[model samples]
Target: MSMKSTVPSAQPDQFVHDHLPPPEQWPELRFDRPELEMPAQVNAVQALFQRAQQAGHAGRPLLRSDERTLSYAQAQSEVNRIANVLTVDLGLVPGNRVLLRGGNSVAMALAWLATVQAGLVAVATMPLLRAKELAAIIAKAQPAAALCDVKLQDELKAALAADAATAGLKLLVFNTGGAEVPHSLEKMAARQCEHSTPCPTAATDIALLAFTSGTTGTPKAAVHTHRDVLAACETWPRHVLRATPDDIVMGSPPLAFTFGLGGLLVFPMWAGASVYFPSIPYTPEAMVQLIGRVGATICYTAPTFYRQMAAFAQQHGIGKLRISVSAGEGLPDATRQLWKQATGLEMLDGIGATEMFHIFISSPPESVRRGAIGRVVPGYEARVVGEDGQELPRGQVGKLAVIGPTGCKYLDEPRQTQYVKAGWNYPGDAFSQDADGYFFYQARTDDMIITAGYNVAGPEVEAALLQHPAVAECGVVGRPDDERGQVVLAYVVLKPGEAAGAPLVKALQDHVKQTLAPYKYPRDVVFVSQLPRTETGKLQRFALRQQAMQTPSRNPTT
Candidate 1:
């Protein structure tokens, strides 16, 4: 395929396309495989639903929960009705943006699907975001309308009030938990026709604007096309995950996050599998219990989530559960061993980015290595490169560079050059590949901690700390030190019924020394009720670093 923009964009609203980086900034996209092929004119919802029906899976359950279950056919009707509400009632046009704010629920999923079906770009946001964060996203994406969960409308209302630009933006609420509200999406959708047609969108038309989680700094919107997401759906999930229609998927990552968007919705829809969203928020213990009670087969969450659930899994049953996916952050060997010992299942660890959309490196349980994050998915090319962008020899740690069907294209940000250079995407992670091509995660490039003369990775120390029974979860970072430049600081969340004090802190430091090099042990330890994390379940290390820099380090052993 040519790298040129051969197909015309069907979008009328040019805001997103206008804001996109130049063609030169795009990482080269390839759809070389047979499965990756699709027609030039593609609506994501239409493509997915058509694929499922072709597979003879349209009649099966596609959405599941205790309150309601919607099969593919039923969900299609609802999506049509919602699409009509967006286009007809709300007068939204193709390429207009719809801001979505909700928890992971059926109504939230329907809004996202309908937004794309109408050829309008969907900007799904985390449910926990406050008015300030929502205001930032609204300022960036400049959505024309917002579909908010009834329970979460307060913050969205505040954001709309806070931002003068959004004063004219219409707001509609749904998933009222049965509030009998008027002018809600459900009420309007109920009056609309259930046979609305899919909008004619070119495959190259922008489908959505996914903002970075901003672990490094200010959030940047990553532009993804209908073709880009469809291409991704073809690679990893079709080849590696291979979810069956009978499989029921569940997870904790918010739908706003790309990881959750793929794991909970897009990938499952591609396979015609069912998704089970807890009506209430999921706690580790509650999630473990619900997995068995609902008979879910596939689970998607981060390693920290799995670590918290392992203890509950021992007390509860994980009925019919098959695949457990770990992403959003680095997976520690200690956490992997604990999960395996408890459930007798080898976790499917993967590495993906918000920029690329989803996982590109992962393997089946049978092929999973002891410490690596599996080989790169077929249909993609990956290599470890030095700072100079030259490929590094195997077993040498360097920046990870990859190119595939989907790559990075930031919205109006100078960081576009930082992400894509010379047709390859740099995810800014440190990794080393083996002779067999297995990729091992080291840490985020900025996550490396330098103290005295030796360099250390925070995840390595966090991994070592997780080996201790008292440590439930932890995030490690570097704290400023006058003599050594910086010292290792670990913020820990202890297990239930465990106490935190000077003795326990020294014990954790000693354990890390035993597990890794003595110099890598955390010089400072802070016990928190819970570590700060993004809605996607990624540790908010930047937050921890801020706290560490503001306060003095505690070295009980010294």
Candidate 2:
């Protein structure tokens, strides 16, 4: 029963091995469909490009923005050029980790495809990450090199400079627009060959290292294989999303998030569809304007964004939109109904995680139930299990256990045992199954908070607060709210001289907003003299939660 690496690759870098869970914990991966079977030596990039070519849509648009549109053929060429630079120019061998930092842009997509094509694992980080946060990931993943947007290189540079672990990290910036920036990926790629062959990687070769805040509140890398990426495309988009070649997809989630990566890039490419990336991050109002202007047929975003944009969509008319997808958080009945009334499009609700890679349970518009999360996707199976890991009877709330083609493979973290047990991935969510096989949500089993569809780890927020000069101690917890389902609330013990008032509270809130994702900012700050701790000196988060629940509510704006 000892944990050991079951499958080792022929590549020089075996960093993935140091972090893989034991073979027995891995889900029983199956490929019953002929389309799902991949060759021993396969590159997911090659398969995606070949799919577009075989569909005879090489000339069709694959990526679109206000500035320009890239055809499938053109996109492939770009990918090949970047791949060439990664291998020939940079001397990046197979299995090397390439950290990618950027928003959802055409250049970012090209870099991601190039990394995979070159047989290197891609570690995509959100653009919102500050230097300290980036430093932690850098120390954990130890990526040899990075490809970043030129505009977003400051924090990454600072991170590398501050952390000795990233001392020699090489950075390649893109979207430099002929600026005299040295080592620009776009500039180097232009001179490289546009016909490099894809790396002869095994189907099971690691393709990505996605970082997720595990139950312990530390960032843990989730290992995903080339086959896993292909399988995701085969299931969700093929069965549920059902995007067609003619559909133009657009969304607000950054490509760094798996949901965004799958929804904005992988799914569209699988169907030979086009995806639109805004020149900048779109506000709720801006997203509606772009949807109307671009004539986007399929939309993907979180529940809160949908609620905020419903009126805008109604006033402006979203006539061209045929499908609206919601995930990242629970979709309230009110938000779903508002979107339906506004756009006449039923919001398809689903539950997914960075561990599974994509949605495993989702309903098509025709089979949707008001409160249920819907049936498991064709390639997956699920059940609710009690604390003892025994299957619970129908309609009983318990831990949600799932097994599918893809499952949790935490990179070299002890939490792997916690997430994967007896070949099933426990996603830390409480749920119940109905007689009809639909799954209904209950609550999160951990201290993580889902605010506006973004998973905010309470400990991560607490760590961020401790970094500020004003904080002596802190505990972060989720407070339930009607608008966002849950909002982050921080209980802080300020420094002796620091005042506890609206001004200091606002300062702490702004500090977190700047330090982490803006959505993770504490909506309410309660000043405390000290935090409750057990005899072992462990902060009693449950005690703090009880206090948070009893505190009088305040307007988030205040």
Candidate 3:
């Protein structure tokens, strides 16, 4: 079928238009609830800002750090001011993509809100991403401007310098601390009015372009609309998180991740609650300390971090924490039990993906189940289906398919065909539905590994490992471990002069850590003279996994 141009005026970036999958391939979208049905000219930012008008929250804190706090009114004013700069000063029209690079901070949150408020699509990149990864995203998204924290500008600058396509990119730096940076968001917004009107964007207009690492060792942009963002707030936070106006939220996941974006920024704001981003990245110990110090009532993080913080919270009382949310990976029963034992609070486990935007299958604390990953949340329908796309029996294991207000919409990639089939989004996870309708995770149908709740594609790790001078050839796979659920294991055939010893293993591991996110580095390495391969020269990852299973490992705890 030929591509039909829809909403051309709203998508000036031809890349977005050219990459959108055919309408038939899109997952079924529903706005069944009256609250879920947004008006035609709905701006999610304006809707979120309205929460400040709720009684008793006008002067209440909305964003807090150790150094300072911004009240609901103040944060909305800042968001408006930044939006003014983006639209009035920078001429960023609705539909233009603005790349955002920064760690989790108040400034970063403001920039994201401002980008969407101005009707521009936000493309947030992880701070740990290097130039090569940044370059790939730039090439795919073709963002016209970037808002970055000054501290995290080096790699983005290198990426822009290296890519000719981005040479003319508009670079705006934030969090400059009164420094005289030319294109600083602080400086730019200072000259703009603090009460700019929100853009009259349609509810279906694209709002964000979240890039996720794909199984093919490249990044794919997941497009989300204004309605989708609002729908996420309506379902998860309203139904599951159930935060109140008085709740104070804190978490470790970076805002660049969708999990963090929803948990730390969107959900709290949706409830007229406040969010606290630690001045610096918090260690599990520091996270526990901050929660107590700030009187945080709700917390969001992965299972591994919760495990590490459980003992710490017990040692120094968890203060006012009433809820602990876990996602990003499966929450181990042991971790859940340990946390419950320590905090006297049950951990809420949910499963969501970059495709779905946020958790669609989760249980409230009242409906807690021991090992199951909860029933499908309200506003979504999920089913386990066989290879032929037929729904399986309650106790059968098959691909997990779901339909919700938001679903997989990959930007200009053929992988969309694999992810969306018959109008159902396949999250690449294998699962089974019990008689009670609870979903039990089996394993990933793809090669992606979830270690410490971070998704690491094995091929991406292999690519990083092969870049090392000492590695002649390599195959990366996930080996089940007691602590992290799974740890990255690499089978390597070194160069002629390299020795197969502990130092070489350490060197290869360190090289991967330097090349990719620290969590993606191979935790265990085994030297091999050759890698199993097919006649076509494709590396046989199955054989490597088989070998890894046969070898005994010293399951090191993180």
For model 1, residues 1-558, the per-residue Cα lDDT tens digits are: 533346687788999999988988889987778887778888888999998989998789999888899999999999999999999998999999999999999999999999999999999988888999989999989999999999899999998998777888989999876578876999899899989899888988988889888787677899888988788899889889989989999999888899999999999999889999998789999999999999999999989889889989988979899999999999999989989999999999999999999999988899999989999998899999998899999999899999988999988889999999999999989999999999999889888899998889999898888889898789999999998988999999898899999999889988988899999999899998988877778888888889899868666535
lDDT of 2 at 366: 90
Worst 10 residues of 1 by lDDT: 1-10
**Candidates sorted on lDDT, descending:** 1, 2, 3
Q: Give the TM-score of each candidate.
A: 0.97, 0.81, 0.81
Model 2 Cα lDDT, one tens digit per residue, 356-400 = 998989999999987787899888888999989999999987889
Winning model by TM-score: 1
Q: What C-alpha lDDT values do all the predictions have?
A: 0.90, 0.83, 0.82
| 1-558 per-residue lDDT for model 3 (tens digits) | 111113323545545655688877887787776667666667888888875585667798889987679998898899989999888888877888999999889999999999998889899988888998889898888898999999999999999999877877889999998998888999989888889888777777788988764333455789988878998999978888899988999997778778889999998988999999888777888989889899999999877578679879899989999999998766656667879999999998998988999999999888988878899988888999999999998998788999877889988888998899988899988788999999987656666677888877776677677667787667778888788888899888887888788777778778888988889988888888987753212356667777888766632323
In model 1, how large is the Cα lDDT of residue 107?
Answer: 93
Model 3 pairs whose backbones collide:
19-412
Angstrom error of the Cα, residue 379, model 3: value is 0.5
Write out the backbone clash pairs for model 2: 19-412
- Spell out the clash pairs found in candidate 1: none
